[model samples]
Target: MWNQPYLETCCRSALHRLTLVGRPGRPDGLKDGPCLRRLEGMGLARQREDGRFEATPAGWDRHALEIVPRKSA
Candidate 1:
């Protein structure tokens, strides 16, 4: 249980989108700019040299723990 930064529902959705494996790590046009920027500010994601954003390692870890649902035992 890490004291991860609180994410808005929309930003959380954006982070999940960024973490999608393969399938082209593209963003949803300008709609995601602010959300991605916020994630960058939190060190959760980073912008690429080509002007696209990708999830950071920290982002991936956060996504797994916070975004992904756990299987009920």
Candidate 2:
């Protein structure tokens, strides 16, 4: 569902890092805003007890599919 360029970039960043700590406004933090809420609703993202945002396995799978294929030189 996160096929848009911006959304994919954000999700990829989150998936690659695995955890986003502290407040939602931080550059590296993922907020519980509309976008994230939708991801959470889809069982893709979750908010941790310590307020960290984490991507689920399904999220990783989806994000992985979006990775660009590298060409062999």
Tens-digit lDDT track of model 2 for 5-38: 3455654555445434323422325363445655
Top candidate by lDDT: 1
Q: Which ten residues in a row have the lowest lDDT in candidate 2?
A: 19-28
Tens-place lDDT per residue, model 1, 26-73, is 553679788989999999988877777889999988888889967779
Candidate 1, residue 67: Cα displacement in angstroms equals 0.5
lDDT of 2: 0.54
Per-candidate local distance difference test: 0.83, 0.54
> Which pairs of residues collide in model 1?
none
What's the residue-level lDDT of 67 in candidate 2? Answer: 47
List runs of model 1 lying over 4 Å from the truth: 21-23, 27-29
Each model's TM-score, in the order given?
Answer: 0.82, 0.49
What's the distance in Å from true for residue 27, model 1?
4.2
